[model samples]
Target: MDIILTSLINLIVFVLGAAIGSFLNVVIYRIPAGLSLLYPPSRCPHCLTRLSPFENFPVFGWLWLRGRCKHCQAPISIRYPLVEAATGLLFLVVLWNTANPVEMIGYWALLSWLVALAFIDLDTLTLPNSLTQSGLVVGLGFQIARGWDNGLNPATVSHALMGGIIGAVLGLWLLDIIAFVGSIALGQTAMGAGDSKLAALMGAWLGWKYLLLAGFIACFLGAFVGGGAIALGWLQRRQPMPFGPFLALAAGLTALWGETILNAYFNLFFPTW
Candidate 1:
């Protein structure tokens, strides 16, 4: 019975994640256009035909439509289905990782938000203040709620969360500072304020120390991909690429495997773990 119930719950969570992914697609498209996500219903960019409810059922809908608009038969981006699948899969992973009900909700919400943030950053090279700021606040709330849920000391929880917030902001600032100096040396702006905010927001959830792990991973990814792009002549040495997606990706990965990696690091160097 427990196994069946768990499977059912996981199915429901995955569906919910898909639903959120659909909404995220809308947010990603509309938010950067300075449009209200709720006001303007989703439409095909090719024909401007409104997508019917059944036609908008996330991944299955995309499959059913064969990746084309039902009204105009215009091709839809394959990225839509991929994003939906990724979000659903990640949701299931988080559900399996989380034992607490509240933590499950919090973690899923955080992942969904990150999905939207990442795509928006990828497409538009901008992270809307709405998503990043809300994620930060919600993450901090989750931290406090976790402390209360576990019956931990209020003072300790407060101090720790504060420390996380401070650490993330300072960490982001440090990255920006490095970028500023690099720009002076390299002759182009390499980082932006949006990435700084995203990093600070990540700090809210992972706190300062693990936020370092996220930053490190983001930097590595940036270096690897940027180097490849440069080598391919797809990008100039001074051209800017979006950093928010890398930061979001790093934060999501760190949220999952950060402690394990951090402990391994400590074991290797400090013998503390």
Candidate 2:
């Protein structure tokens, strides 16, 4: 009975997350387009047909509609269902990682922001200052709550706070330097302001030490994927690729495995510390 109840709860969380993902899709697509997210309701971009309640059932709705607008027969972007599924999976992952309700809710909020940023950056290649600032505020609140709940030593909290600040400063400065150099070499902007804001946001959440890990992982992943695309002749040398998604991916991974990664590094270097 207990097992069944747990499974049911998980299912409910997944469904709720999917619903939130559906709404996030609105924010992601409409915000970049300069459209009001709430005013017109969800409509077919091709036909301007407003989506009915039955047509708006998150992942299932898209699948049931066969990926086309009901009225105009226009094909919908696969991102709708994909985003919903991704959010659902992330919800489960966060629950699994943090059993504490407070921590779970906090991380849920954090991941939602990350999801929104991921899509917005993919669409516009820009991260709105609004989202970044909001995330920073939320992250600080989470840190404080977690610190208080866990009875962390003052020194640990101090370290974490310092780490967060250093992460933001270093991430921004490093990206700026890279952008400056790239502009000189390529004679154009190679990085977007969104990527910088994203790095700072990640820093605020994960702190400086983990930010380094996340950035390194993102760069490595980007190189691997980009190189593969180049080798397949799918992308040319000068093709612009958005880096925010990769950073988000790295941040997500780090959020899950950061402590283990950090501990391993410490074991390798300090051994007794």
Best by TM-score: 1
The lDDT for every candidate, in the order shown, is 0.83, 0.84
Worst 10 residues of 2 by lDDT: 155-164
**Predicted structure 2, TM vs. truth:** 0.87
Candidate 1: what lDDT? Answer: 0.83
Q: Count the clashes in each prediction.
A: 0, 0
What tens-digit string does per-residue lDDT give for candidate 1 at 1-273? 999998998889888888888888888888899888887687888998888988888899999999999988999998887888789899899877777887788778778888898898888888888888888888888777776677668886787668667766876686788689978988877677777778878888778888888899999998999999999999988777988788888988888778888888889999944
Residue-level lDDT tens digits of model 2 in 46-128 = 99999998799889999999999999999999999999988998999998888788778877887898999988887777888
RMSD (Cα, Å) for all candidates, in order, is 2.0, 2.7
In candidate 2, how many Å is residue 253 off? 0.5
